[model samples]
Target chain A: MTTAATTHHSAVLEHRDRFRPRQAAGKGHVSVRNVDIVFDTHHGPHTAVQGAQLEIQPGEFVCLLGPSGCGKSTLMNVVAGFVKPRHGELLVDGQPVAGPGPDRGMVFQQHSLFPWKTVKDNVAFGPLMAGVGPREAESVSRTFLSLVGLSGYADAYPSTLSGGMQQRVGIARALANYPSVLLMDEPFGALDAQTRTMMQENLLEIWSEFRNTVLFVTHDIDEAIFLSDRIVVMSASPGRIIADIRVKLERPRQAELLTSPAFMALKRECLALIREQTLHAFEQQNRKH
Target chain B: MSVKPGPFQASSAVVPSSTGERGVIQADGAATETVVGTDAVGAAVEASHARLPANWRRYLVRIAALVVAVMIWHLAAVNDLNLYLRFENVPNPVVVGTEFIAQLSSQTFYLHILHSMERIAIAYGLAVVIGIALGVMMGRSRFAEDIILPYIEILRPIPAVAWIPLAILMMPTEQASIVFITFLGALFPIVLNTVHGVEQTPKVLVRAARSLGASNAAILRHVVLPGALPSIVAGLAIGMGVAWFSLLAGEIISGQYGIGYFTWSAYTLVEYPKIIIGMLVIGGLGSLCTLLVRKGCAPLLRWQKEAGRS
Candidate 1:
């Protein structure tokens, strides 16, 4: 029985390998060049991000960490091609981003899994949209579902699963596309602390395997510190990159590492950086009011 | 996990039911049924609650209420208690019941029913197709909405019954005129509801699909359609109810043979009992048709059931 399970697991992995993009191709090299994003609000034109310049190396796990209402998500969306920059250029590898495409996969804060579809179908949607055959898409879904440890829930509806499970499926769906860049917009922000931590670990494990360049947007300092190779701190509202701190921690990170001195040091650094900016933003709001 | 299997241990080997709601919530990816929050009496109550299908129970209650209403009507008519209502002229339950049973044996009665069903099926089906197509077009494109919305708004306000004169004049055949009236009745609700549903589809889901490589057409087919479905279903339900009303109105006014015509004819002949029988038949058939529609659409709406269950 164990051998059968192992064989099946390996078979799925093999199938995944066959479908997986060329190793070099899968690792996204994103370059955001002095990008500015403006939104025409009911009040007036509001700058969401201003002069946001950042470059992510291939296979790097980067987090855009900032306070609420910060344009971290907006900047990430620019990379995802959901939001076009008003000025300056955003490129993936050397190609300029025109709009959202197959090369970049996104996981939203709200597990936007198509409720009409079953778990496997939702995961297979990317492949099917990319014009893969139904049979092959189904198999790709199976492999990714297994990858996210949700192999048994292939037939279940998204609404049936708990929030954490739904998010896991969301991750699996994103990964199934074999995207060069995985863009996450506060993906685990809605989950409870325990689930959030577990998801973080699960995400790292998956990232370690796939090594797709992940651009995670979040307000949580601890999460950024834990999951990212580099934490890019941005100032609140009309967000600008303030600090870039590389995580010096070892890989294969465990739950116990949260208490480790190295982890605490990084967390403290990020917390202080965020705190100063948050206070500044608060005072600015007060002045405006 | 120490379980020494003995005959005296657990009265029943506890089945690990997720309940998908309460219990010591399992923090696993799989919705594993953890054996927590066990209480024999509580479990029995919950099991009973779960076992008794809500839909069946709801229908049973409706049937009971209907029966009670009929019994009261019977009592009032039989006793000639015109205290509030004119019960003296009304047919009693016994007379109506006997007529109803007799009508069931008559081929003419079946023909009336079959005719009514066929008319409703065609009209309602046409309404659904046209309404959905128009609604989707309006919802997706601002230009379409601007161009077509004024005409829809103008026509939608005018009652389906009011359309009968124009419909009869416009259409050559009586059947076509009746069907047109019924079609008009069902169209507006379906179209409006579909529009609302389409417009309400979350932008996030569309963006997510787009990021996943779905083309604009694919997004519309998969995301917009399903997202708008609950509202569309609500519209369809309302559209169906209106269709029945319009069918009956059209039939009463101009139909050669239908359940509505049967009731109208009975009234003309002053056969009070046959009128009541016809009314009851119409009510029963209408309820049954609506129930069938809801049942047919149930599988499409399984995702919503999970929320209600939990």
Candidate 2:
């Protein structure tokens, strides 16, 4: 196991030097200012996110941690420019986000892959859409597929792959465009616990090499602590940010760190915050009923 | 315990060595043998041994059923069986077979078959183009759907046969009239299915495409078109069948040289054997056209079959 890890580490380093010259600094800064999102349901206008504010530095890894219906995904979608915020605005790299563009890549939970395309073609889609020539697009796809350890299955269709493999392909497809920011909405949420752990590690390794800003959304406390540099916890019932907890754990984290006392402490803090918010949400629902 | 590296080692290695070892152990336990056991080898041999005879038996049963049906038809016609329904005027299978052979040697039979095929080709091609265009417009824009969909709904349920008299009066020639009827028959299914396919395209895919920097036209081209293909292909197949149904109606009423005209003229001339032969030829041609549609679209849908396998 140690030898394999060392070999993979060296390979990642070697590829980092060759294919991914470190991204220029100050490229992927994300600022969400007083954002509010609302949906008009049959009953009335429902507020999804309320006065949310966040700032992620270039090359930072941040996770939006919350329970279901807390609007964490909605907030991420706002950043991805898929949803229009009813009130405030979002800016990426100092530019206002008018709509979804190639500058920000997104990974959904599962089944977001173009099932009609081959794994290679799915990865190549972004570059091709950017008007890159077919040959260059093909090479770019090959590079990213190898980065995700999926070079062998490039010819296979998305549906033929396991969930973990599909998510890996989704990551490759997103990164192939060389987006300034990568937004992942529960990318590993559908995988088994074991697969999810491995995916998290792989994602961190890729992020370290690319050093692109990533805004990850998840409900798992351990996952947020394990992957992100900062964990932004949100509350349900008019979803809003409640806590912006910075993780002080050291870099190049391993699976073994998951058992470390420092990790557990962060987990404890997040758990308490989430429990309080969940109870508050429950009480609000009860009062409405 | 020793761990054997699987063929998928490069990809599975991403799972971390600990889980990979667990996977090996699970595989060994499932085989209920030593780590290097011949259990998988034995299963392969047994499965191959079992499959051939089962497939052979299935084919034999199908052929037997078809042969029995033909034999019953032959017997009934020969005996002049009439119990509330008459087989007395019906031609025997042997006589029909002889007449079919005779028709196959004649140039007029070929001409009739060609006329029917040509009408279907022109009509179905027009339907595919117009239906998809209208469907995409309706699907992508609410204003287009509201304007166009009402007229489609009102016109769709009327059968192709009902259009024959009006089509003949409106068209300049018999061929044009027959083609118009066939086009009407095919148009609705293609339009309806294309609309359903476009509307059914997953919203997530559209979002994914947009985030990947695709423009509106690019999204429609890459995401919407491919996503709606299976449904469109289904519509094409249905439209082909309906085109044949309506083509025959139009051809029988007004066509100078077509399979439907040949069949009806045979009936009027009391050429019973030729009529049976004409019916068989029409059935064969229809099946052939449908088979062509499916075969032509198979390559586009190969991913669907691969996905279904797992």
Candidate 3:
């Protein structure tokens, strides 16, 4: 089922590759080498990401594309410095990742907006955390919210927002940090297909304006192929980068690009890699059970 | 941001609940998956909603029934039921109502009510102050929760009335004993509710405060305290109810002056009308005080149940 889905994804992406718009963010790069993540579970410490290495150049969009249980998110966390690898290092801006910091802002699959806080306040959280006064935070937050097309939702609470709108606020909050590196883990994986596509386009548009290095994680090959300047296909369980597909696409890419051949070609290749990895991971789990 | 919490929210268990260890995820502070309305979850929720009693009809019926009952009693008493074997001392409903009104004018009766209310007020106030402090402390700290909780649980089952004899013996005077009895009644519910409220304060709110650079004290003040307000008010309501009941019982058992004492004194003289009037006064005061407490707490607890659906 997954293989067929991946194939379909690749076909669509190949169609969009005709118009894969590239943005210039060649100045900021993220480097990860043999990043190994082992989490302690009830049975034992399980290795999630293993020997995953990738070089995401500055101002370029790179997607860590893989199926669920492929450790795509763990790798993103490793890059963001939110997770420390048991072996090897993940670097941002030529420095080894240590702990979560302001330089790399993360937007998770779930919108982590504070429920009691207004949209403006949620967007301003990072600035406030960084000791910016309310006046300064509000000013910066408004700009980001406006960028996310949420200028009118400043005083509204997140509960009032549609899923798509909340995701926009999440993106705004992450962007408001003014981070050089943006790390997103399945950020749009929860959205409906239509909304997800809209967000993908919105993401690229935002990246075009801000022009920062982004390490986006997703299970969707089409999404990776469409949005990423370079796509890193990861294997399941002990995740490793199997393929680094460079999307030869143009800048300011639109929805119409999903019909192009080049995009489909990359998507097909990544889909094949992800299906094999996911099936194998499932087998490994079944065997252990 | 739609942070207005749902009405009747029973976030009974924190997220990742299957794991026994206290791993709290404050959904209140974080955005949860606008959970896809999977058929299974939706069906279960619908079932629960359907099972909920539509009690408005029952409530109206109960009010009607109570009115009918009162009318029956007034009619029974007014229509010569007191004439047969019942002594003239058993004043009819009209005479009893007159006596109640007359008693309200008498300075002696007013003093009796004043003494009873003053004792209950002092004890209930003390219970509120001390119970909340201890409860909040226990709720916040794991060590305190462990140390103080067992003792509270052990003492809670014992009736407040059971402490009357001990209170009378320990206190130097009857008034002090009465106050102590009220304290016994009010203390447990207040402390338990406060602890539960504090304990249940969303960890996410606390984390949100932490992320915003709020200090520990600030987190407690801005998040935990406000988060616990509704539950604390609920506790106050329960504790106040208990205090008034205990006050009446204490006055009846051992008192020189008070409504309880006056009622029993009237009973000995076969003045059933006076006894009934005393009961009426006690019931009226209990309800009025409860209303006052509710009024006082409502504004402070304006954040109560708003969001309904998950």
Candidate 4:
């Protein structure tokens, strides 16, 4: 059974490599150039994000870290092509983002999976939509489901699965399309602490294997630090890139790294910057009131 | 884990452990089950074991209530009880019972039932198709809504009874008029509810579909349709009820063979007992049709129940 499983795994790996040849140097390059997003509200035109300039290399994991209403998510959505920036452009692999496509996979904060579909079907949806044959889509779903440790729940509906499990399926679903860039809008924000930690670990494991460019958005400083190679901190509101801090911590990180000296130092640096911005934002709000 | 010999115990063992892991992942599944397990399971076990007796008791209670009602009716009719209302001309329970039994074996009685059923089936089926199509279009596109909504809003409030004269004039035959009234009765509720369902489909799901490389047409077919289904099913059930209501109204005025016509004709001939029988048959058939709608839609909505429970 072990030998058979190993061979099957290897064959799937070979098939995947052939299907999407990984550019060893540059493939999933994301560039956000002076991107500004504004929402027309009842009051007036509100700036959600401003002058958001950043570049993510192929296979790099970057987190847009900010407080609530900081428009970190909006910036990420621009890359996902769900939101059109008022100014500047988003480019993925040298092509301008016109609209959402299979090349850029996204995981929302919660309840994004098609509830009517079984877990296997949900994971297979991208492949099916991309015009993959039914049998091949089913096989791809199986492979991704197993990758997320949800092989037993292939037939179960998304509603039947736990939140963590649903998010795992979400990840699997996103990855099944072999997207060049994975955009996550605080996917683990809804999970409990323990589950969130486990999910982070699981995501890292998957990232190590696939090496897709990931642009994750989150409010949690620790989560951003733990998950990404670099953390792009944003101002509280009318969000702009305030700081770009590289996580020098070694990869294959464990839960214990949360308390390490280097980790704490980085966290302190992030905390000070975030505190100043949050205070400034509060004072601005007070003046408006 | 300790080995359990009994099937129940073994099953319980598996459920708790597997669901415990699931709980950690989400906390809604295992936590509730484990906390309430002993009491809930015991109650369930007792209910299952004594289901036969319990069912019998329920039937007996229903029978008793109905018997009491019938006894009152019998007493009132026999006594010729009159205050503000008159029972002097009313047939007693025994007379109606006898008439019902007689009608049960009659070929004409079956024909009346078959006619009503056939009309309802045709009208309701048409309502389901046209209502859903129009509803989806209206919900998805502002242009469609702008063009179609005025007609829907104006027609929706007008009761089916009011449409009888216009329908009779509009349709060529009595059967066509009656079916048209029934179709009109069913259409509005279905179309309105379907519109609501389509509009209520989550924005995130659409975005997810888009991100997954689904085209606009694919999103509609796969995401919007399924998302709107639960509400559509609800609309269908309500529409089935309204269809029966209008069918009876139409049949009383225009149908030659339906139960409504049978009841009205009985009133004209002073066959009071048969009138009661016809009324009862109509009630029974309406309930049955609604039950069929719910049962037919249950498989499509299985996920909703599971999600609600969790």
Tens digit per residue, CA lDDT, model 3, B160-233: 67888898899999999999888878887778767776787664345434434456676677667765665566
Q: Please identify model 3 stretches exceeding 4 Å from their true place.
A: A1-36, A51-60, A74-106, A124-144, A177-181, A239-241, A273-289, B1-64, B79-92, B107-140, B170-184, B190-230, B254-271, B274-306
- lDDT by residue (tens digit), candidate 3, A108-181: 77635655467898887767766667887787777677667677778876665666677788888877766677
Q: CA lDDT, every prediction? A: 0.79, 0.80, 0.69, 0.81
* Residues B96-134 of candidate 2: C-alpha lDDT, one tens digit per residue: 988888888999999999999999999999998998899
| Tens digits of per-residue lDDT for model 1, B1-310 | 1111121111221212222222221112111112222122243345557667775877688889999998999899988986777889898988988888898899999999999999999999999999999989999999999998999878877777788888889999999998998898888877887887788777888998999999989999999998777667667766777788888889999978999999999999998898988887887887677656656766776665544444
Cα-based lDDT at residue B261, candidate 2: 97
| Distance from true location, Cα of B285 in model 1, Å | 1.2
lDDT of 1 by residue, A1-289 (tens): 3554455456545655666535344459999999999999999999989888899998899999887877999899899998888999999989999999878999999748887789999999988987788999998898778667677779977776777777878988988888889999999998778777878887886776667799999988888888889999888666888778898788978677888888888788767766776677668768988
Q: Where does candidate 2 clash, by residue pair?
A: none
Alpha carbon lDDT of residue B75, candidate 2? Answer: 95
Ranking by TM-score: 2, 4, 1, 3
Model 3: residue A34 alpha-carbon error in angstroms: 4.9
Candidate 4 chain B minimal-lDDT segment of 10 residues: B20-29
Docking quality (DockQ) for each candidate: 0.28, 0.32, 0.11, 0.28
TM-score of every candidate's chain A = 0.90, 0.89, 0.83, 0.91
Chain B, model 2, TM-score against the native?
Answer: 0.83
**What C-alpha lDDT, on a 0 to 100 scale, does residue A289 get in candidate 4?**
89
Q: What is the interface RMSD of each candidate, in Å?
A: 10.1, 8.4, 12.6, 9.0
Off by over 4 Å in 4: A1-25, A272-289, B1-56
The alpha-carbon lDDT assigned to residue A125 of candidate 1 equals 95
lDDT, residue B42, candidate 1: 45
lDDT tens digits by residue: candidate 4, B117-145: 99999999999999999989999999999
